[model samples]
Target chain A: MATVIVHKAGLLTMVQDRGRFGYQRYGMPVSGAMDVFSLELANLLVGNDPGDACLEATISGPELEFTGSTWIAITGAVWDPHLNGQGIPMNTAVDVRPGDRLGFRGLRSGCRTYIAFAGGIAVPSVMDSQSTYLRAGIGGFQGRGLIQGDELPLGTYNALLPGNELPPGEATDLLPSDGLTLGKAKRKPRRTKIPEGLIPEYKHEQTIRVISGPEVHYFELAGLRSFLSTEYTVTTKSDRMGYRLSGEPIKHKEGMTNIISAGISLGTVQVPGDGQPIILMADRQTSGGYARIANVITADFTLLAQMRPGDEIRFTETTLDRARLFCTDRHRVIFGI
Target chain B: MKEVTLKYIPSGDSAFIIKAGDVISEEVNLVVRKLLARFEEENIPGVTDFIPSYNELMVCYDPVTVDYRQLLGIFKKCAADLGAMTLPDAGVVHVPVLYGGEEGPDLHYVAEYNGLAEEDVIRIHSSADCLVYMLGFTPGFCYLGGMDKRIATPRQETPRLKIPAGSVGIAGEQTGIYPMESPGGWQLIGLTPLRLFNPDSKPEFLFNAGDYIRFYPIDKDEFEQIAAGVADGTYQVRRTQKIDNGDGNRT
Candidate 1:
């Protein structure tokens, strides 16, 4: 099999597939690509299975050299890519001959970048997934991140068609020119009139919608009102496990003791006794003791994940019907249903 | 009978909440268990998993197969019929624990805080039969439901960066076993010699929700022997049960 050699491993690079699902009961987080859209796009460009294992580079990208001919695509985070000392474009396929070098510069806008090769990467599966769970130290390159001098085996399907060449175009045009502008332009246009049959805008700068918590009355009215109206900044302590937001301390109405630990899920914004709100992420524990204030809709969870440290976020109350429609529609769009 | 308010809160598009009560009491646990039993019997469509906490049960469903409203209705019906239902026959599991000394480094501190001798602490802990209320916090980490009131202790002021796997501990009124070495804040009293979870094993988990657990104190020599058996793949700690219903209940 062909192999790719890492020359300079970047900030954080790990092999990730879609994610590890149906294993949450085992206390394992769904460790996968942070940006699913970009990951899939990279795979689609190279004709790999949508769920094929790819390299997820965070903040910065890795430098590598190929030992055999292969087709590859890089997407996400507008990382400046280069092939054999020459700059390459993002979101398109590239043919790399044997002994050629490939590398990426630091990220410009987003936090994650995806690199997908034809046929996908070859790695041992743990718990039915090739994705790396860094916390558990299993799966993906011996269940860890790629290191310099490490050689990754390419899958049997990594072969390119005979005489396949790079698509005919000026590659520079494909490079995202104004990443910041593009991101803002992609958002829905602001409108005053609520059109019939059109899905309502769930995205907002402030006021995240929330339902009355299972233990809403357990907290005093002052604490509840403060949680509903106040703004909280995502703390620097945030990671894949959970986002610890700093805001006003929420106090209990009376002397309350410990509660039994129960099952928790992604987007469950739990408020501990200290009043700090923790928005659990994909890698959160299966259970916790804090009283949950609200659960962010799954549709908006990806957006919340994209927020950088020190970003301010607020919650607003939403009905079940609206949240359901938003989630269903977003899923359909994401999976191309 | 004390009036308890059980609120049904929507968790997300695919899940609903059944809040039994505010505090962790025997009654709340019973209601949680009763609801869990009914959900298992009905096998409602779209319901993938149900997790019970001290006072709430979060039921997650597939949005495509069933909506939040439909699941909520079923939950309400189940809550109303809880009085007529009986808990499933739970299996009993005996776990061998190695208490005090090096194996349980925190045992002395726990004993001193409880104003008892190390041996006395062991007696009180092993005598009580704990219920596995839920499997959460980590894989194979059982949220046990019993702790002698006298031996109950608060968690550490600051969580330890890492606690070894199989470490048994008590936090507040709850007692549990840590299946994996992770950063924990619980006050440890002892440790079990058996592996609680192994990804390579056929049945990755040693315990499941609704199971009964009994701790059996073992000497350091026995603990080492069992640990060796676990590492070498010769130990068989799981007990098999036969169910005639042939439905998906057992699986």
Candidate 2:
């Protein structure tokens, strides 16, 4: 069995998969990977299923020691990953041998990074998922984040290897030409990179698209205009539960911020009595009593998750049809359909 | 049949809200419950899950498999079918509560606010049958209705960092139990040893949305004994058939 020993567990590191669904009606949250695009890509690059469990690191990255040879990939943030004190590129698959040390030094951009092993992380699923919820403490590695000296068992590999597997080379070998390393040494694993054009650009400022919430009429026209026109900075209070934005107060039409508590889904922008928009995320409470202003489109959810504190974001109103189109387009990119 | 307009409003790209009415009443809640049962029977292709509340239902679906127009058409058909279906009876569950003293830190406060003795407050609370309006905010946390307005009091000025599980609280006109340890602002009036939510248990939740819950007061000694039985998994949750009043009200 393969294993990875944690040396320096950076900021917040936890195992996550697609998400835990079918339990939201019981007031249980669908906690999962914050950025689904990067998580899937990392899994695919390592020849694993798209929703395979992987490690999500915030701010910084972890230093790990591998016990057996395996394929790995790092995605999402612009972290400077290194293997055995040597620099490695992102969005590409790499091979690790026994005693190889993998770590990250500096974070250039983005808020979170995902690390995927060949067969996925072997963590017990509490509710058919390995996503760590943190608050409830019921999923992932011991239902919590990884700490120094922790050892995580890797999933057993039994699937047949692809006919044209290649051992990844330098950055120049990332293109399609002569990338295959077929019939190579057993220790030298195959590596490949996603096309450069497909890599999402992580920027400091972003304009997120949203659909009008069910209770949009509760807000005044001026308040709606201000919400769409102004740029809000992500506050420090932001977490996986919700992003508390700091900006102009979005006043209600009749000071009615409270509502009959209803189910709150991911990306629902809820405005409480304080008037600031709180965008509920993966780990948000199952339901809330605040008036929902808008919901971020599914296409931009991963982009929103990669946003760090102090990052500025502006809202743009879009129709539900357009949002659905964005979802189909994203699925095409991720699944290569 | 109630003459109610069920409006389907898009909540997001993947979810939509079906509003039964504007007010929280028995009529609206019955519609919500009936719709949930109908949807379950219909087994719509892409409707992944749903949350039924006091006056509305939030339906979440997989966009990859079903489009919004297709989902809307399915819901319309389900609504029509709901008219012909006979709604199921609401289940009745009895709750044993330890009221007043260490078991209920806010019982005296509630009594003082209502200008009555602590025992009188308990009698008023446990006398009437409570209706389960919805379950939200937390796992197995039921938003109960039918609390007598006489003992109603405002929430505490400062919320407690942690309220123990099974602690019954009163916030304004609503009465509920803390299914798990969490920060809460409701005024606690009693405690119950029953686990409202036990993931390892067969049925993770104790009460359904359209059930009836009646609380019966128990002494501290009885509470400890029941607590032990609960810990050993030998305590049987007391349940009985709710007798209907022949006027659409269940007792």
Candidate 3:
């Protein structure tokens, strides 16, 4: 088995896959990569399945020493990643030799970054997922965040790469180009030669499209208007559990109070008694008592997850049809169809 | 035996909330869990997860795998079968608790707040077979129903920084057992010997929604002995089949 040694554990790093599924009945959270789009891209770049476990680093990233030769793709938040002191581009596969060190020394734009090894980050999966739920101490590496001296095992992957249409030295390689990903674009159902176009630009201020939540009617029209129109700054209290945004207080209707505790799906923008919108994320509780004024649509969920403390975000109401269209478009881009 | 209204509320684009009722009642919760049992037995693909809450069951699906409109249609059909569905027998879990003293830091306060003695509070709490409404906030933390109103107490003005695992607490009308250490405002009245959540063990959670918990007081010696056994994985959790009353309420 290949291994990646954690030289320096970043701010918050853990192994995550698609998420834990089919266990919500036990009140288990489906914890996975907060920005799953980047997770999938990282996996696909290394010829692994979308649900393959990988390293998810929040804000600051780790310094890893690879003990075996493997391909790795870094995605999501930009951290100005470096390989053995040489800079490497984000969203591109970089081949590493045995004993090569990979590290991210500085931040660029995003708050989270993903590094997918050739196969996957080998870890004992709880409830069929390697995602870490720190609150409950479930899943991932020792059911907790990565720390210094933690040696992560890597999974074995197949040699066949998807979109291997270009011959050797065909497309511009972010690093030295002579490997499996060289000729991978000209075949039927053509894959994009370079993934640069697909990478979303991380920004300080972004718009997150949302659909009305079940308790949206509980709020007054002014509250709804303010929610959509005002810029909500992500508070420092944000983590894998949820992001508490500080903005114009969304006023509820007179006599309207907290609803009976109901199910909270990912991206649920719940408004508590204080009237601030709390966007539930990957590690959110299965249920909550606060009223949900809106749910961030699946399309803009990744963008919402990338927002950092003090970063501004505005909610834009979108139709379900439009939300579906956006999700479909992203999938099409992923498959390069 | 009453027919409660079930409304299909769309939650974002990836899930649907099947609201069984506007209020939290046994009838509504039963309907929600009934729909869950029925929905689980279905062959619907793409619907990845189900969360049965106090008054609603949210079904999450992958829009890429199954069309949104098609899933909504499937859920509507599933909700239609609630009348024919019969709920499974409730599992009664006997939980051993060490009440008062250091184990229950707020037990005296609870009794004082309710104007009752601590022993009365314990007797009232342990006598009734409380229904497990749902589990959330933290893993294995159950939302309970059917607590004696005489023992009901308000939450602390300031929540403790860390409430230990296995701590039984009461807040407002709800009673809960913290599966793990978490910061909470609930008034701690006792500490349970059983581990509500053991991730390394099979059946990670001890109780589920639609189950029942009966708390029995134990002495400090018994608590320590049981805790040792639990730590070594030798403790057997006591469980029994809850005999149903004429009413369909699990309580």
Candidate 4:
């Protein structure tokens, strides 16, 4: 069996799948890859299922050693990765022989990265998911993050193509870094002509729309107006659990001490008694007792995940029709309709 | 009967909330449990999960398959039929515990804070058969009702980083089990040898949303034996309640 040995683990690295669903009622959070787009793309490039388990590295990538021949691809956040003291390109598949060393340095853009293999990593599924929830200490590599000398087992691989025929691309040189070429690399192949009305323009800077929540009346008129109009900067304390936004303190109608704990979800902006807004993320708790003023639509949640700490974010008020249209469009793209 | 107001709030894109009261009350918990039982019997078309809290029920659904309007309709129907629904009969769970010493380090402080002897506190805690109001905060961690008001105390100012699993503790008017080792602010009085949660086991969770629990004190040696058995995978505990079948008998 092929194996990947962890030599130098980054700040935070964990194997993540789509997520643990159908367990929220049991008080389990849907812990998974923070950036779903990149994770799926990496898996797709390697001929694996889109939702297959992949390593999710935060900011920095891990230094690993392959014990057998395997095909691997890297995606998300321009991390300059190198194999055996040579460079490897991002978004393209590469072959690694046994005893080859692979590692990454710092990030060029983006905060997360994904690495997928030809055969998925073998890990036990907890509650039908391989995703790790560190808080509960379960799922993914003995319910913990990878440490030094951890040998992860790889499943058997089916050879679809010869490794010699695969084109070797330029080691992904992170922008603003000195160019040090490794092996002979080829340019990306030309894209095929797309059918009319098939392509969607990638939107980078767009206002996230949200719907008023059950506790909308709890906030004063001015607070609600500020929440919709003003731009708030995401604080450095952001994580999978929630994003703590720094903005005007939302004033409640009354200084309620303790509201009854209720269900919470991703993108639910809860204003605690402290008046600051906490946007719950993928690994948020099942229920909370804070007053939520608005919930970001599912379509815009990926944009929120891409946001870096200190990035300014503005909430745009939109009707349910607009939100539904956005969600339908996203679904169509995902399903290739 | 005291009049109680229940309000429905939207939880998210596909969930609704049925709140009974603001605080933890026996009457509110009873209503919440009864409503959950009715929903199970009806088996609403789109309702995927219904999580009952101390005074609220968070019902989730798939928005693609079911809309908020349809969920609201079913919720209204469930609320209307709630009066006639019979709650599942409560089962008394006698959980053996070892109090104080190495097993329970906070037992002395808890007794001193409540101005009662160690034995008195144990008696008060184990005497009443408490009702499981909700299963939340963590898996199998039951939020129980029926704590004696005389011994009621607030949570610890500073939460313990890791409380051992199966440790019986009290927080405010409610008492609960630490199903897993997690950071909590509850006051620990005793330890139980029972495994509150095990993912490998059938049913996964030891207790459901509406079961009754009683604490029976066990000695240190017994606690060690049971704990060892739990570790080696030989100990088995039954946490099911008898239900009436369609026939003229109870199963």
Candidate 5:
């Protein structure tokens, strides 16, 4: 049982995989890594499955001391990562020896970052997912953020699968289901350096792609136009649950503010009576009553998750068909599927 | 069987909602549940998860493994076959609750607002058999229906950040129990000595969607005893098979 010792615990750092699925009907939100693309790439660099659990840090990254030698990679958010007080590259694998401390200096961009080890986090998954839902106190490292003195057990799944855990019959359901598993113990060549073209560049301003929501017709003509045409800044009240944007108030039609509370999804842009739009995120409730105007497409989920508070963003309309194409393109990049 | 009315609406790239009807009624929820049962029975490949709500069922699928067009075809087939669907019997869970005093901070306010005595308010709330419209907001939280309008009360102006688990609250026409401590605005009337949700236990959820809850008042002493029993997983929760008369009208 190898462990990663937390030296200086970073802000809101938690273990996350793709997320917990098959439980939404039971009132559970699919809690997982904020930026899925970055997490998947980070895993790839460390010879882990695309859906392997990794440490996700918000704003500031954590300083961890490795108990054993392993290959580690950091991705998402532009942060100055340091290996034993020396700067290391982002989006690429870095070798670590026993007692070597991994730390970060400064965050250049993005709100969340991922640190993926060769075998991924060994935390026993809750409901088949290592993703943490802090509110419910379920999943991830003790269902909460990383704290100092917390020693994280690391799983050995990168280079080789333990003899007992092989075969599709024994495979567990993980977020972004992995297809890279081989039947035998063979050295899984991890990517030492990722191609420059594959990396996502974070910016202060971004154009988020979305489609009309279930109740888009309930919005007034002006509200609909304003929602697409205007620029909204991510408010300080943003987190994994939802991002309450502060900008032009997108009004609903008269007597259309409320709807029967129904099911909602990730990236649902629901507008309350106050006319302020809130983009549901990783930890949003399973269902909501507020009339929704638009929903961010699945392809742009990674792009939206990386945006920080105060970052300017505008909505661009995209059809579901086009959205599916973008999602397939993403899978091709990471999983080659 | 009632004529099923459904409209399939795409939500995002990976999911879509099957809107049963325009309004929130027992018929609509029944239809939603029936449709959900079929999907469960079919266990169609590529269709991953579902969120069955009051008047809609949100189906989440993996676009990479499933073809959206073919999935919609399966959904349409389900809708066409829905009229022949028969609902499973609903389970009635009798939950013992401690009303008023420290457990119910807003009981007096509710009574005064509704121009009734505290006893009257308690009688009205406890007498009605509430439907489990859905379980949401947090795990094991019941989105109930069938609360008598006489005891209806508005939510608190400022929601409490941490409402304790097993709290019975009423907001507008809806009465719900918080299975876990969460931020909520409903006016609380009592506390139930039951674990609505516990992952470590055999039944992770005490009750699920499409179930029924009947509240019966108990004293604080009994509440404590039951709470202790619940904590140690010793108390047997009271349950009865819902008498399914025609038209979902059970009194």
Candidate 6:
């Protein structure tokens, strides 16, 4: 039973797992880590399950102090992580002792970063996921992001491994706390780095892949051409819920923008009456009334998730089968299956 | 068996939209519900969830376990044999609404816009049984269809910053309960005492797509009583069988 204390909660840091599923029919959005690839990679670096709960820090990262010795890995959004004033590298596992402080500076690239522990965050899962749905105020860290002075419980996923327990009163600052002890022998830390080739490149401008939405025909030829040709800039109002894009207004055929509200997914590019496109994300409502012009492909969602406001995005059409192949191929790369 | 034609449209690489008809109708919705029920019973591998709207049903699936062609084959087979499948009856829910005065805020405007008296507005809104076309926009939010066209009013020119949960509103031909606090443009006419959506509650949502809803007016005292009962976990919404009136009763 380990715990970590939060000193500064950062811009927005919330515990997130793979996602909440099998409940979308009940109007529950599958809130999860926006960038699944990075979340899973961080978890894998620390020997945790792919779906293990991790801290997703947005814009800025949280400042934390470990109450017990544990392993951690940071991935995504190139946040300058530091442990006791020592700069730490991203996508690599690192060990921290009791009373060791971990902090972050301004982000270098991307929008969200994931910090995973060897043993996942021990938060009660609501509807079978630790992911936080902020709008509903349910799941994750008491149904919200971490706050200053918050103590986050960490699970023990490696009980069978050699003990890392410590002796009594060894660390002067931390008292002999229950469920934790000072270790005698300092074991050499084990670390692993993700291959450079496997790391995704985050840039200011990106071309995302998409398949024509069910209502693609609702747009005229000129609108379709413009949608493909134009580069849409992410607006300032973008959040975990959705990204509002400002570009050439996609002209719809007369009386075509409005639709009977229907189910929406993670990457649905919905064009409303205003003609601007909104790409629904993790915290999006289960359904929407706007006509979906296209859906960003599954593999490209990781690329889209890392984008920040003021970034430009262009869409390229891909076939359904090809998109499925891209997704399977990415899974194979991540799981090595 | 109803003679309905369902067109399978690919919503995305990972989902399919089974369109029952071009327009929203009870018959089309019934077909969508039947397909959803059949898909649930079939327990198709890789199928994640089914969302049934007014005239279409969206089926989300895992691309890793299922491909577009294979999923289409399964859906096509289901559509072919859908006529023989028997589905359970949709639930009928009774919602008690407190219309007009402080709770609604926009009830008078709606009445004035429709050129009808406040009482006439309430009666017209409550007399007809509404269909829960879908649970969308928010958790437990029901998109209802059955507003008397004469009483229909346009939405507020400027949207309210925060519309309280359980607020009933009208936007064009549709009527709905907010279920949760959200910024909306709909012209609100009433507020329901029941908790339509609660994460802690069993079933979590009060209304599901395809459920029949009937709104009955309640006094403020009764609203307070129901609200207290709901807070204390003793309240239960009254439900009854919904009879269908033939020959263009509600389209």
Question: Which residues of candidate 3, in runs, are more than 4 Å off?
Answer: A159-194, B245-251
Per-residue alpha-carbon lDDT of model 3 for B10-57, expressed as tens digits? 888888898888787777888888888888889689988889988899
Against the unseen true structure, what C-alpha lDDT does each candidate score? 0.71, 0.83, 0.83, 0.72, 0.83, 0.82
Best candidate according to DockQ: 5
Score every model by TM-score. Answer: 0.80, 0.92, 0.92, 0.82, 0.92, 0.91
- Model 6 has a DockQ score of 0.58
- What does candidate 2's lDDT look like per residue over B168-190, in tens digits? 99999888899989999999999
Give candidates' CA RMSD values in order.
8.3, 5.5, 4.9, 7.5, 4.8, 4.5
Candidate 4 — which residues are off by over 4 angstroms? A69-71, A82-101, A157-206, B1-9, B14-50, B61-84, B238-251
Better of 2 and 3 by lDDT: 2
Clashing pairs in 4: none
Q: Report the C-alpha displacement of residue A168, candidate 3, in angstroms.
A: 16
| Tens digits of lDDT, candidate 6, B1-251 | 66787888877777888899878777778788888877777788998778788888889887777888888888888778887765555567888999998788888988899898989889998888888877776777777887789888888889999999989999987788887799999988999989987877777788777788888999999999999999999998898765443212332
- The parts of candidate 2 lying over 4 Å away from their true place are A159-191, B245-251
Candidate 2 lands at a TM-score of 0.92
Give the chain B TM-score achieved by candidate 2.
Answer: 0.95
Q: Give the lowest summed-lDDT range of ten residues in model 2 chain A.
A: A180-189
Tell me the RMSD of model 6 versus the true structure. 4.5
Question: Which ten-residue region of model 4 chain B has the weakest summed lDDT?
Answer: B242-251
RMSD of 2: 5.5
Per-residue alpha-carbon lDDT of model 1 for B141-250, expressed as tens digits?
A: 77777778888888899999989999998888878888889988888878898888887877777886666788879998898899999999998784534231112244
Question: For candidate 5, lDDT tens digit of each residue in B1-251?
Answer: 76766888888777899998988888888888888988888888877679988999999888777878899998888678877766766888999989999899999999999999999999999997889988777777778989999998999999999889999999998899998988899999999989888866766788878888899999989999999999887899998878882245454
lDDT of 3 by residue, A1-337 (tens): 5588998998899988889987776788899999999888887776667767888999898999987666778889877888999998778778786678999876878888989876576677787778888877778889899999999877644333444422222122222223432222111223212357677788999988999999999999999999999999999999898999999999999867588888888899999878888999998888888888888888787787788999999889998899899998998789662
TM-score of chain B of each: 0.83, 0.95, 0.94, 0.84, 0.93, 0.92
On residues A284-327, what C-alpha lDDT tens digit does candidate 4 reach at each position?
88777788788887667656776778777889877555665676
- Ranking the candidates on DockQ from highest down gives 5, 3, 2, 6, 1, 4
Q: Over the stretch A1-337, how does candidate 5's per-residue lDDT look in tens digits? A: 3479998887789998989888887788898988888988888777777878999999988989987766778999888898889999998877776688999987888889999886677776677788988988888889899999999987644333332122121122111223533111123534567787877778889999998999999998999999999999999999999999988989788999988888888889999998889999988888889997888988787778999899988999999889888888878876752
Candidate 1: where is the Cα deviation over 4 Å? A47-52, A68-71, A93-97, A156-213, A216-231, A248-260, A334-337, B1-7, B25-27, B30-48, B62-66, B70-88, B112-115, B154-161, B185-187, B238-251
